[model samples]
Target: MRRLLALLVLLVLPLAGAHAQGDPPGVKGLFLLTDYPSQTVRAGEVTTIRVKVNNAGLVPEPLALSLQGVPAGWKADILGGGQPVAAVMAGVNQDVTVQIRVEVPKDAKPGSQNLVLNARGQIGQQASLPLTLTVGTETPAKLSLKSRLPSLRGTPRSAFEYTLTVGNDSGKDLTVALSAQGPANFQSTFTEGFGSNEISSIPIEAGQTKDIKLKVTPPRDVKAGDYPVLVKVAAEGATAEMRVTLQVSGQGKLALSTKDGRLSGEAEIGKASTYTLILNNDGTAPVEEVEMSGTVPANWKVEFNPKTIPSIAPNDKKEVQVAVTPADKAIAGDYVASFRANGRGEQASADFRITVTTSTLWGIVGVGVIAVALLVLLGAVARFGRR
Candidate 1:
């Protein structure tokens, strides 16, 4: 009877040990947090925290998850109702995704909000890795200014147009003010909503581009040269600027005229006759440093009224004189003289025709002898008739 009982006890002990191996008494698995991003989130943003309950035991068990330490405006949701998982098999892993939402007000100060997620199961209870929630005010929008028309090159009194490109690099919308500064004569105008010489607010969204036109007109009296103009763009907390060059040029008109097409006075050899040529500036611009030169007959001389005339303003005119003389031994039927005037990008010339006549002398002696002979003949005729 004793031998039979020992055999029965040994069999029962082996069976109990087999059941114990199937179901472990203490927690024998790792409940790890997975699927959750690096534990930090911005205010007003939502982040998902995931927990993976890994069971490395011989038996299955249930799992329960819960969240804690969330701020007032923040909230968290767990999968499986924070209840114990029905049965997590030994050496098997279970996954849980918890969503954390942060609702920070606009007035929320910049600081860190601490959050914790606790997952409990039959095997053990595991706390999730600490998550840091950063709350702060949104960043301001960024603004930039660009000029499409690089330079303006035109005569004074003429209007010039410039196009401007405005870019917004912020993550939000922005309204920018526009202005310009340069020479007093330089005038600028923008699109309808964007006025001239005032704060023009333009609404631009993040990563957006807009085009505007700026019409610049220099005063009529402005000199010919390069002038710099500044274009400014400003937003709530951002500002930008661009520079433009305004080039002014001179404007003028030139005309040429002659007193006579032909030169006709009869003169002896070695005598001279003069003719005139005129140049005028009809436009409202000055002509400076006049000069006259051209090929002409050797005996001809060309001269200007004022050898080096100063600047001739609008509606001003200047004259030049030319003189022609024949050589003493030359017989002159007709001669041509040509000349040209150069000043302020203008040129002109004239041709002159000269005639020379023979000198007077001898013939009076022959006429006196012929008259005496006629008188003698008449006297003889009268005497014969009386006899």
Candidate 2:
């Protein structure tokens, strides 16, 4: 009984260890599986399917991939990591995914075709997966583009921003290029809706949509009118276009100068000298709320009679009087004085040349003192001669 019990123990131990390690006893297998084993495809279009290679308690090995029973006029290839691959490796109890891309010819008949995807290991393990494809009518690649705000109104200095949605209806992923058509000197750029960095193209997945932003900036000298812009998108064998409008409004162009276009003026120390300034509106829009300001030498005074003008019509000019005074200790020489005017977000500045001279009161006092001294000297000489 002891011998029998010992033998039974030995037999059970080996079997238990084998079962715990992996598959029990003689169970070893490799499998190829896909959720979509049977599907329909369109002629002249390419499609890919995912396949999984599972190693169930089989020794880790590399298997070569091949397709069997493929009909003529059909193209099939296995892909791994976006590259064509002929073999794949799966460790014991591990699973790996591979892609099988199929391209059907346009001239093929509309009927059912059967194909087999196979993976064979060097140690004599083989796995086969059967697939069915029903070739039907043509399915064309397509794209769509739409803008949320089709038209915008702003000045030439403003950037017109537009939000757009791009959709991919094709059966595959694609990289699409973006472009725009508009008048000369009009700048345009594309970016993601949530991002500020610019992009010329973007990748989109099948049956999905992406939001993008378009910013258009026109030249400062652009005329006020309605301008149209054409936005285009192109992808692999498909294209789309959209039209948008930019309503550019007129803006005020303010300029500052003297009547004779001279930038020089004269001012006396401790006294204000008046200057005539010409403020011209050269744009199509009216200038409003024009404010005058000046920069002069240290401790000097300056002021405008009319601190601010109400408005100036297009192609019109306004005359303003500005008084500038030099500092008391300023030497007699040339000095530069700058004056600026601002109106409706427009600014202009001009420089004036000023020369200083001493006042007449100081000279008169000096002459009087000299005459008094001369009279005293003459009286002294007469007295000395009499003594």
Candidate 3:
């Protein structure tokens, strides 16, 4: 029984020491702390210090906050949820944060002052924290913008995205307005670095940085060359600028057809027929080193005059002579042949219906053979009639 009583005394002793709060380690019940207990402020400007009311192993209580030892002509307010509030309720093992917004006068001298934060709880609980605030000469507001990649290369049809970081080095929160200038007929907009919603301006806290994405699009008819882009971010009469480049590459489109736009022709059996094969470059760039080819029926023969072309200019056409011959035993029927032209990473093909006809010399021989057979049949009938 005596040993049991000793154990209970040990647990109660630790609880007794928890109420004695004076910056000691593991001091429980209630206390307030700011991440930065000391900070420097500029005259004629405003600054914000965040303070949290922490309740560790204590019952829920209401904490009333006030600042002590503030200099004269200085305006200070503790804000909760963007408004001035007198007190906040802190739950067990919870932290309640507030912002202390301090505004200094323009004529304030450069010096240091000690400010005390006092919190009074409803359950006879009281805690105090000390803060050091120094007023210094006013520094000019400044902004900076930097890009991860200042230049990019792609085709005119590609999506040019640039990643940029905007920094605010002032003493107060700022709303930064974004703008950009690019080549004529180009569209540019600002969005979240990893998002798609476009925005014109964003809010940034002092000494903080935000990443933004800039998307640019050029006209489909844009030529191949280097394009310059200028980006600007301004706030509170301070501006930051950055210049970037877009290297666009041109491309070409190919078209294959006959000049008359006819895809049908006539060829004789076992004889080669020559037809004009037209190739056109309908794009902004030239087509180079184009090789001619064709797909014909089985056992048939095909060839091209000047089998390869050197180049075809933009909006220009080149004609080649294609000699397509039908098979030796090819019957009188229609056949399909595909002609193609490949060059500069582009290709074009056209299908032509070729009608095959027997030679006139063979036709004449067939007529003579039929006539001889008819005459032989008539003579045999006359000989049998005389018998």
lDDT of 2 by residue, 146-193 (tens): 988999999989999999899989877788899999999999999998
User: 142 in model 2: Cα distance from truth in Å?
Assistant: 2.6
lDDT of 3 at 66: 88
Tens digit of per-residue lDDT, candidate 1, span 47-155? 5454555543334445455557866655555544444333333243334343444455545567877766554556554445566666655677678777656797888
What's the TM for model 1? 0.38
Model 1 is weakest, by summed lDDT over 10 consecutive residues, at 85-94
Give lDDT per model, in order: 0.62, 0.88, 0.88
Each prediction's TM-score against the native? Answer: 0.38, 0.63, 0.58
**Candidate 1: C-alpha lDDT:** 0.62
Sorted on lDDT, best first, the list reads 3, 2, 1
* Per-residue lDDT value at 338 in model 1: 58
